[model samples]
Structure formats: structure tokens, C-alpha cells
Target: MVLLGCLVEAMHANYHGSYSSIQNRSSSIRVAHCMTGTPRTLYKEEVYTAYRHQVLDVLPGDLFVVLEHINKTEMIHGTRVRADNAIRYKSALKYLSPRIVEWISIGDSLGSIETRSGYAKWKRCFDHIQRTERINGMKYDFIVRTRPDLYFAKALPKPSKLPKDKILINPYYECVNDIPSGYDRKWAKNLDLCDLTNYGVSDLFAIVPRALAYPYMCVAYITDLPLAICGERAHQAECAIKATLHKANVTYEFWPFVVKIKHVS
Candidate 1:
């Protein structure tokens, strides 16, 4: 009976292996998108030009931009920021004046969005991307989630090798060990290859496959982690979590040291 059971298991394994080997490879074209919104203060022409100059420097051609705002009509109608404003100059380059390929904006209150909180806002941005993908029949090999308020401290790191599992910003122990720690523990449990340590916070700065983002969107939500405030204060929580977490695979790269800070003030 034991030998017969072994024979059955081996046959099943072989059949499954053959089936998986024939699966088609996903597309390699990647789309790196930034999700931005308006700041509290109005900008002068020089400030706006400087902002545009700095923004265009780090932006790549292969990107899908998403601009979120509290009010779109007010913005486009010139009641908020004014049409002749530099904000318009930047917005025009992407979606309004003359869209040059991959830029768009959605009213913050429109659609099924969640922007009041940090974590919710990030997930809502992911949701927007997912809906856009479905509508346009677009599929990406990689999806980089970036923030608009961010200033590049260095060059973006080349993406790491995509593992068979999800690439998390934190360490690999939480998933492998089946232990409990960190914020959003439920979110941690749902992931196959995840980190409770950071909850992929640096993902404000991430490069992940589109496929992985689907499951993560529904499950592996970002939790509270140490954050760098204007490069002055490093959130100690994330630093501590990172220090304690075990490193199994080299799936993430820290890039703050490399980003060239173009705007400050």
C-alpha cells in the first residue's frame, strides 16, 4: 500500500510539473506610476517651474501617472489654482493641456476611493490602477508605486529579481515562521511571502509585478512602519522592525541614500 501511494504521488507531481512548464510567460513591459495630489499652499510661477523641472528629471517615459486632487473642477475651472498657473503647466504636460502618453487625474472624492488615511489612500491608488487595467486591457510585467510628494534622494534602484513569491520591503520571517508580530497582523497572515516588519512601507517606493499587486490589494495591506520625515527623522518603529526581521531572500533594495533631493522648501 505504501509503495502504491508513493507511485501515485510521484505520478501526480510529474503531471503537474509538465503542466506548469507550458504556461505562457507574462509580458515584460513595465509601467511605473506616480500618485500625486495638490499641496495646501499655492505656488508662485518660479516655484511652479522649479517643481516641474525637478519632477521631470526623475520621471521616466515608461510611466503611467495618476494625479489625485480634492477637487478637479475647481482645479481645471481655474477657481482653485488658476489655469495660467504652473500647476496647470505640470498637469497639462500629463493629462489636461496636452497629454503626452501616460498621465491622468481623478477627483479624490470620485469613484470608490479611500484617501483620508495613509494606508487607505495607497490601497485606493492601487484600486484605481486595477480598474484602469481592466478598462484598457493593459497588463504590466512590473508596477512601481510612487508618491508625488516624494523628492528623489538618489537614483531609483534597478528592480530586484522577482521571486516566485511576493517581494516585501520588510524581512521574510513573518511568512515563513508563522509567527505573529507587527501592525496589521491579519494583513500579514494573508500573504504567502510577506513581512510584518515593514508592511512594504518603502513601497511608497516599490517595484512589484502587477499580478502580485492584485492579491496584495485585497490582502497584504501596508501597515504602520518607520517613515522618514523630510529626511530628517527616521521613524524608529520601521527601523526596529527591519532590524529584528530575518533576511532570507534579497528581494528589496533601500534607495534613500541614492535619491537626489531636488526640492527642499
Candidate 2:
């Protein structure tokens, strides 16, 4: 009887020891880069190539790419190029590789209401979050919202320093000397930080915790933006997003990142 009891105790200890070791192994931060929106003027091949090296290869977590299927023809470098949604979709799957948790393809048509395109873009991002959670049964610690048209020259800043209740955003270019003149310089400066004016936060890239990700992404659905803002789609989206965060009492941090726009003009 004593020998049997001793054997059970030894087995229990070994099992817990193994469990602890497994936990330790996976303690590294888990991040998810959610790339949303249409592939407009960007070259699908080159964009994915840079994404492979900059994001997938460098970042140490899963990727979820959500692309809208919009068949728009535009001139690229004075050459007419038909942006084929199907080809770009395939290219993403091929290049993103093993780190991709799922590639969500959403329809291109903006619904009955002819709202700004930014509304649709934000909606797609929200959909990706819901779909990813359903598939994995777990949420990512950090979520990055960015577009495909922008090319990253280096890996994104790690998310270990971000607070759970705050959203991290990329710094906007200074207004006085950065942007082409004629616009309100004071408004531009205010826009750089989260402010009440409708100038808008930088819409290029944002890193947020799971808690704030849902609210930030759902800004489109909850609010109806003004006509002036709607006219400027990107800026309107940024304003709405920042406003959402502000309402929720979620703070923000500005992190500077220099990226090239893959526009062939």
C-alpha cells in the first residue's frame, strides 16, 4: 500500500513539471498583423515580397490578411494595369507562408448605403477579427492594422511595451514643413495627437491590444461621420477611430515609422 501511494506522488510531480516547462516555452509574446483593404496601385508581387521579409520573417507571431476583391483599373507608371483581385489573393497566400493563421477574402461591393470607402475598410477589419477568433478559439495579444499599398522597409516595432488599455499609432508627418502648404498648419499639428478637431489621426498604421482592437475597428458601424469628413475618406476614418478610443477612455501612443508608398505615378 505504501509503495503504490509513493508511485502516484512521483507521477503527479513529473506531470506538473512537464506542464510548467511547456508554459515557459510558449511565454513569448503573440502578435497578429491584420492587413486590411484593397490592393489599389501597389504591385502585388513586390508588396508581398517586402511583406515576406519585413513582417512574416521578422515578426514572431501569426498573420491574418483580409483583402477586399475590387476590380479597379488604374494607371501604374503611365501603364494601364487592371488590378486583378484573384491574382493578388493567390500571391498573398503563397508569400505570407506558414505564419498566416488565415487569409480572409471579403467581397468588394460597398453595401446599399453609399458611405465613404473608409467605412467598408474598417468593417472588413472588424470582420477579420471575428473570423480569426472563431477559427482559433483564442485572441491575439497584439493586433496591427495596416494597408497593403504601403511598403515597410523594416520590421514593425515589437508590441511588448504597449499597454493593454491604450492604442499605439504611427506618428503623422509634421504639418508646417512636411506636407505641401496651403492647409491649416495648426490643424495638422493637432491631428498629430488625439484631438477634438476633425483633422484626423494617422490612418497608415496602428497597433492596439485586443481590448481596444474591437472598438477601434468597429468605429465605422457605430458612428455616422460628417459630410466634410466623409469627403476625405482616410482622414474621416482616422478621426472616427481616434474619437472611438477617446470615448472609451483608451489612451494612445505615437510611434514613428517611415514607410514608402508603393504608388507608381
Candidate 3:
């Protein structure tokens, strides 16, 4: 186990090629975007078109895109926005024909309806992933939960490590012990002191196959952190946690790509 972990460690350092190099690449491509719409409306294709053009024009490859749908409360014009997300997924796949887009739906019945309620629903999505993993005959290989309103202003990047068996998530976002309330640090630290080699996990994005994501989500869900906290914190916490897990013998990595976009409509 130790030998295998050592191999993953050596490979991670070499893969990043120094922190500055990764940061330079990240600055060049920002991926997440926020889009606004009525409950039952289909997202505009033009927006997606423009986003794809901007990001893909810079980098191109197989991309794993995770879209999360929130709030199943409103029944709009006989249609649920949660359902609309699946439709949007279809539109995205068709609109962005050239790029490989894999979509996953994580929905909740809580949110804006009430802050506490919303958090509860978010937790459900995480619980679902964990339960799904125990099924005897399941199909999904990867599972992700993200905000429904989020849009991709840029093209999503291909995960650096193999996606099937490794856990990958944005290393820049994770839970930490102590720091300024709003300070942003792009480096990975604090989590550098653990041994987790029995599992293959990566920083930030937690890029893993269906098998690993299931368990990872279970942990996140059971812990009860706010969605926004999870998302924003991953930017820094992910790096630290991923590195710590890696050092502990967890086989994981930090994937480089544009993962954020503007929230403006």
C-alpha cells in the first residue's frame, strides 16, 4: 500500500509541474457560469453556444460536465424546473455536439422555500449517491451534485487523471480548520498529514468512477456542510484535503481546467 501511495505521490508532483504552472493554466480558462430562468423555462442555447466557443477555442478534449438541479418545490405551468434540467441536459448535449458531455442530475425538494429546508434537500442528493452504491445492479459510473442554476460560461476541462477509478473534484474547495473568514489562498496545505491509500481519490473535483463518487458523496452528505460552503471552500480546501489524503496513501489528483463562470445573467 505504501509503495503504491509513493507512486501516486511522485506522479502528482510531476503532473502539476509546480504550483505556478497550474495557476497560470487555471487563470487562462475559467469554466463555471451562473444562469437565471423561470421555473419551467428551457435555458437559451445561444448562451451555451457562446460559452462553449470561448472555452473550447482555448482547450479541447473529452469533458465530464456535472450539472445539479435544485428545488423541486415549484410546479410551474404543470412542469417542474427540476424536470426541466433533464431537458436542458439534452439540449446541452445536442447544442455542444462536438464535446463529450456527461450529465448527472441531483435534485432536492428543499431550497429558497426555506434555508433549512433547502439544506435538507441538498443532503438528500448526497444520501442518494451513497445508497445507490450499495445496489446490486447499478449503472452510473460517476455521481455529482451541483447547483441547478449554475451555467458553464466556459468549456469544462478534461480531468487529468483517469476518471473511471480515481476520485476528482476541484482541489481549491474543501473544509479547513482555521483561516480568515473570506481570505482566498490558492495553495494546498493543512491536509498534508494523513495516510489514505486504501482508496484512490483526487483533490478538489474528487474525480473517481461511479464506485468512488458514491462513497465520497456519502461522506459529504453525512457531514452536513452548506452547498455554497462546499462549492466555494473546495477552491482551497480541496487542495489541502486531497493532498493530505494522497499523502495518507489515497490515490487522487488535482485536475486542471476552467471550473468556474460568472454568476451574472
TM-score between candidate 1 and the true structure: 0.42
Better of 2 and 3 by lDDT: 2
RMSD of 3: 14.6
Tens digits of per-residue lDDT, candidate 2, 180-258, equal 2221122322443343254566677777787766656655554443435323443554666555565656777655455
lDDT comparing candidate 2 with the true structure = 0.54
lDDT (tens digit, per residue) of candidate 3 on 92-204: 54554421122223442222222221333223333333323233233343443333333444344343323565544443323333322221333242243332222123321
- Please state the error at residue 191 of candidate 3 in Å: 12
Tens digit per residue, CA lDDT, model 1, 169-262: 4223334444333222323323556433334233334555565554333222323322332123234323322322222122343222222123
The estimated TM-scores of all candidates read 0.42, 0.65, 0.35
Best by TM-score: 2
Over 4 Å off, model 2: 1-27, 41-45, 73-83, 98-114, 176-198, 224-235
CA-lDDT, candidates in order: 0.35, 0.54, 0.34
Model 3: worst 10 consecutive residues (lDDT sum): 12-21
Model 2 clash pairs? none
